[model samples]
Target: MSTTNEAALSLAGVDKIYALNSRKPVHAVQALDLDVRKGEIVALLGSSGCGKTSTLRMIAGFESVTRGSITLAGRRIETLAPARRGVAMAFEGYSLYPPLTVRDNIAFALKSARINATEVDKAVKEMAALVEIESILDRYPTSISGGQQQRASLARALVRPADLYLLDEPMGQLEPRLRALLRGRLKRLLNERGMTSIFVTHDQTEANALADRVAVMEGGVLQQMANQTELKERPANLYVATFIGEPPMNVFDAKVEIGERVRFIVKDGPALDFSATAFSQAARVAIARRARAVIGVRPHDIRLGAGDNAAKVVSNQWLGDQSHLALDVAGKLMVAVAFDQVNASRGEIMRYEVSSTKLHVFDADSGEAVSHGAEAA
Candidate 1:
């Protein structure tokens, strides 16, 4: 395990296992390694049952680490009590005191530290304004909407000074518009304060918009961790490529054919030819060995009008600024996003071109990206 001298939070080979009653132990987290720098925000991103919440719980000391270690500011903290670690957490459940007004709720943490009345008042006011809940300051938790309650909880977490902050689905209860609004505000606030923070969310938009880096997790395992640009342009594997995109990348089984120009033929669908120099040595070797491979392309990377691959439009959905076209190519379903008006209708056969410059080749068996645009020369 590597030690980060200045990391605000570090997890080295961390594991969380639940010993069941008369059954096998469940490994909820497995040998996870991650580092978050001081004053940097990193998002723990993945789908449900991916161990994101379990990892957060372990960090907060609500769950025990079965093995390995966690450190905060160079101090080992996996064994520390939740409060002893100086970390503030806001959860999806508001966890607000129902009898208390918003102001009192936000002031609770500060008051617990025996801060003076004047200081508490000033801090509470600033936090309410920051979370844009000043108008609801005097309202009891039970009387306010879920969004309002979430803001109050967030403010409570933010009002107190702490070495680190953890927010688990803080905006999960809000409507889309409200979530977007709070996401922007929360991101800017965290940046301005320079608070070391970890945001746990399943929403990709939330992760991409807010965090400096994102750690993608899967069933009890860390898949990949990288900045948004790296994840998009150079995904570590097929799962990252498929899971990180909005509409998701289109992937289909393909065979590489040796020719003057290497050709990729999608099973029963389409074929694209790339110059020999366009392929990397690894890809060339894979092709020569007849290793199973797949071709992936983002929807926006497919050109609508002309190519060797002919597809029939299954459906077209007009979404204002753009349209989504569901196409059937040789009985396989494929999708493309058209920015301009598409002149085809359902059942209309059309020839389409894929941006050969933007192709992603993956080893079918291992599901890892082998090359980009066949590693363009």
Candidate 2:
């Protein structure tokens, strides 16, 4: 997190609403408060209709802010026209001028900045090459493929000099290999130029690969914002705990029983018993205060071979680099990942272990996190 003085963009309690003539208004964004540091890259990450796109539009001045303020480069920009906001944006729809060549489209903003024609041409070519659209520079937008047009759109927005850049699914149309290649190049370009940017992406890999930090949104609200590792290891709540992980975190409803030893009894399932020394005093106190909790364990943390718990193997798949096992633990499905292949058959009994140090406890009622591992959240 950057200090207020170092922030390049800030949204304070921003909201966006669409009024209906004869019905209740739709709140697209709700009290969004975010800050992007100078030279930092952030990703707005969420599923479709989670307010991620609406938040981007509001920041770019395409949608009106229904409440609160927007500050960019030390100026209030909520009420400013898009052009006056000093923000360059790449649209997911590829809003390129159909009549113009790709070269001219990329040069449009540079021309507006009063750069000479020679410099504009040079800048356009560099950006086009970076996005792998150099060969299509002479082609019109209407004649180019969707992927090519998307690159052209990206080139146009990135070629311009601005205080900030907002990219909406910038390389979504590109194939996997190309998308991965461009992600590296784009990251380098942003770093070399010290460009402060915020990109919208529903793809978790894209967000993790490109951004310094990721903001996860859902139901018109911001769930959590942090770097990739923090988002994985210390998710703020249940929504983020399940949303950020691969294969998702395996969660089970349980009641915490405090005694000589701490025990988490799964609802009509197995009991996870642990010594009192396994958890910190604060973690024990927090767990004791809750009537019920949802315990989460990552797939990778479930150890196979031997332990107190017995599970029936449902299925096992060796996915080239790793093995994924689906097991039925006391009637509950639990997925586990292993680096080595497991010679187990369906319906076979297997011993597994879930250490208390690998547990994440959440308040069952409010869905808020209570503790992670041995520490209180």
Candidate 3:
């Protein structure tokens, strides 16, 4: 909440709907509302075609909204030309003029701001150094590495006297390690300059690492907005819960009376609530609501107990740091995480243990979480 207005850029009830040649209409962004506070990084995240790009473009003044308004530092800019929006943008496609040197390109923004030539030179030099492109400042865009060229493109965006910075999949084409490295550096640059930014990315991990808050969208509709902890632990809806975590949230179904404590019953498997009273009053109220509420527990929080590896581990997706185990239980899926010695094989029955507090409960009908006790009650 603090971040939105503090954000240099914001979209207040912004809407974008497209009407094809003669067919029906497709809503690109549905009454979307968001704020990218000054000095804060907000990530607009969603699957492909889920409006993440559309939303970013609108803020950059690249796309016009069919309805709703756009505001930057309290001034409306929805109908303004992209060049007059006072917003800097770095997107997947390079907008750099190939003939210009890195220094010249970085100075382009300052020139447009009516800054004097002397000051433009100083700002361009500073921005070039910040993005590690100073060495290539004199080189033509065609001569630089893709990464360096992109860095220059980014530096150019930063040189501008804009209220907000919009990054639309700016790292989309970079290698993984480089992407990770740039993400940290880019975030630092924004902070050092005290600039507000709205970053769009489909990678949840990236969003988690870079943003002060993340906004999740699906089918042109925003699902939720929150910090990393809230997004991962207290997702408002099932999609947010499932979309934010890596190896994802291990889930199972159970039904119990309110105030009753019971580990989800697994046929011949270790109980998630295997340790009695280790559970909580809220969890009981949660399970009873569903007649079968889904129990979601993160992988790292679970383990194959002693004799716990007895249940058959039917499916496993190994990804270096951890392995995702999918065990079959009474014709349902029971996922778990094994850290140290992952010696179990597929269909090899294994035992598991889950922390009571770590278990997440969700409504069966709405797919939203039945968390916070009151909802469960």
Candidate 4:
């Protein structure tokens, strides 16, 4: 789906294997494929051991790829050394030299590249200002706080221009407030400078805030890659639908009947009539199978006292801007968001409805999106 000629970085059929002593080789990454376009920030997002770090390491040339190729600016570089690949990397471990001051750390790459002293100094100052570490340029690595050290590492990686930039959880160690601040600043800086960047992060907030596109990975395989809107509103599968949102999407198994009126029958719960809603042909065919299917709806899509579903309030939590209601529909627990202040008590029966367009249909057995609906949802 990406043009190699226009890409800043591309990976095809990439794999990484770790050998054990008389044991099966662990496949850390498998048949991974990705393309990061020029002047865009793409986030590699997944939980721990999901191979995000391994993928970044492979691209950076710190780890060798067992198979496949990596390309930077239309040139193959999987087998190239890190230095020859012309990629800058900032690590979570803050791999700064202990003896070097923050200013010197940032200037090292430029100096090594034979850039003049005045130019290197100017570049260091500019990078430090961009990362908000200019005041601490003289501090040693051991003298600064964890957050400062992270900024220093980022400054060093971004000080010199390169074909690509790889950042491994660069903000994972920072406080929440600082992380939020830096996310905005980093995104602005990258966009303004027209830099191509790939950052690995397990935090969905970080991905949503900073990335132009997000590649979601699980068990060494890429599940989906799309902009935040698509990933949230039209997930490729159940993993992505549930994985990308805060409070997550609520999905429940049900039996669908495509008779005179389309209906969803919850096991032991009330049946829901969706006859008024028009479904896709594929969705109709999938429903005709009458097999087990799941219905996914975002918390905001479930409205109280509005439609064809009923649930008992299990708990009510009042967040500042909204409220979270935990409901028990038959034997299953469902979460719904209420925009207004709610004073409903536990055990109270609440009637709710799901918006027709916001519904996500998936095959219950495979956990794959049956409809793969449009973005307006």
Candidate 5:
């Protein structure tokens, strides 16, 4: 890991607990340390109610920390007011004032910053053009497309010079096609501006696409935080494994042999053997115990065979560029990414093959990766 950061923002041992005395006191965030370097976009990704939102709120000073500190450009800002921290935020639910015109909405932050009137006007016009909303400056939020309105909201946050940007699911209001289009634009905007951004979203695809680094959170705890390639190639644990991929990594019980002709023992069936290296007797025994060694492989790693054997098709979902086929490999559903056309049907028995080298093995006992050293990659 390159331990260098001309860091724009850093968090060390941060925690947050809301309504401490209440029966349902939410342990929203805990013991988190992260660094966002200059010109990078980092994502706090997880399902709803995970620490992603709470962490962003804490960083933005909208929520008080139960413990730890936040620093901006090397200055501790935990106790600073949100505005004093030089932070800007765009959120879900479209927080723009409905009555204000697009131009006025984008200019609100300039007014709050006490910028000169002429400069604020100039800034407003520039922002309007940047967001492609110059033609709709007089239009109210109700009159513009939700996509345009989201850009207006985004433009509003960019009006003032700030140390960090906190975006909480800003694309939730737009349609799918527009969301995709805006995602690319948003990425380019942040990259070109060299902004330190923390974006919160549960959308895995968006998180994967936009972040320079991904911080995976779950149930108020961080599961893993690393570059996209590292997280996918070497997951820290099963939680991170299941959360980061599209259609998800396929997981099923199996045992691995660390010897010649390595064997994969799936419950209630014969062992699928593959050869070469890496697998020890001790490792195999350990994997067998979680009474279930989890074998997780990505969709593209599974090969669709021409005949019925140990697998059968369950469903074929036509996902634009590719047809994703789900199959019943024993009881666990296995998926295949047919790079070409898919013409399979339910209950049709077919031969299925797993790319053993591309397989992911987990300790059935702890749900952690088993092969370490050279095998882990």
Candidate 6:
């Protein structure tokens, strides 16, 4: 990670509000503060209407900031025109010129910068090949497929020289295999050139595969910003804890009681009792202060076939590589994943165990994380 002095782009207290006629104003982005270091690849991840796209547009100068300051390469650019912001953006809509061929579209920026004709052609060809669009270089926008058009649009933006690059759903139109292939190539290109970039995507796989860090957004608010591992193992709050992981984290309302043994009494369910030494002093104190809390555990952490607790298997599915089991544990639904295929049938009784080391505790009222594993969060 780079220091603040080495930041390539910075946003401070940025907000975007759209006032409709005779309707309440919509807050698309809210007091967002972000920093992108030189050569760092950051992914803005969120579901639809989560403001990830709005944040990208605001940074690219395509959307006006209702409030806040944007600085790029030491210059304030919030009020600047899109063309004057030194930022290049690839739109999700494939905004290629209908009359221009793919080659011409990719070479437009170079030509506008007064590069020689030979150099422009060379650059265009290289970019087209990089994006697997070399075969469609002579085709016009209307003559190409959506995926081809998307590649051409991406090549057009990536071929340009800019201080920062913003991509909105860059490969949304490609098939799964092609998307995965391009993800590697794109990461290599960005790293080789040391280009600072921010991309918007709803796919967690894309974000995890491409970005050095991910900024998660929800309801126009920044939830958390961290690398994939941190977001998974040490999420900032309940929203991120549940949102970042696949199958999500399973949470249950519980009452904490610390004594010779630490016990979490599930609401109208079972009691998960553990040794007091399983948690650190800080974690014990935090849990003791809250009478009621939420306890979470990942599906992968639940071990089947050996424990005191009994559960009824609701459904079991073999996903070719792993087994996904839905269980009714103490009257609550819980999902567990196992690497090996189990021969258990629906309605069969099974034993499961979750160690205290795999447990996560959060505040019941605010949904804020208190501890992860045996340590304080």
Query: Any runs in candidate 1 off by more than 4 Å, and if so which?
Result: 1-5, 20-22, 286-290
lDDT of 3 by residue, 46-134 (tens): 89999989988888778888889888887899999997888888866767888788788888777766889999988888777766676
Q: What does the lDDT read for residue 136 in candidate 4?
A: 90
Candidate 5 Cα errors over 4 Å, as ranges: 1-4, 142-147, 256-259, 276-292, 306-309, 317-320, 342-345, 372-374
**lDDT on C-alpha atoms for all candidate structures:** 0.85, 0.91, 0.74, 0.86, 0.79, 0.90
Query: In model 6, which runs have C-alpha deviations exceeding 4 angstroms?
Result: 1-5, 20-23
**lDDT score, residue 264, model 6?**
92
lDDT of 2 by residue, 247-275 (tens): 88999999889867889998767899999
Task: Please identify model 4 stretches exceeding 4 Å from their true place.
Answer: 1-5, 20-22, 372-377
The deviation in Å at residue 215 for candidate 2 is 0.3
Alpha-carbon RMSD of each model: 2.9, 1.7, 3.6, 2.5, 3.3, 1.7
* Candidate 5 lDDT, 147-213, residue by residue in tens: 7877788888877788898888877777788678778877877887787889988887888888899
Sorted by TM-score (best first), the order is: 2, 6, 4, 1, 5, 3
Give a tens-digit lDDT track for model 6, residues 113-139. 999999898889888888898888998
Better of 2 and 6 by TM-score: 2
For model 3, the local distance difference test gives 0.74
- TM-score of every prediction relative to native: 0.94, 0.97, 0.85, 0.95, 0.88, 0.96
**Candidate of highest TM-score:** 2
Worst 10 residues of 1 by lDDT: 1-10
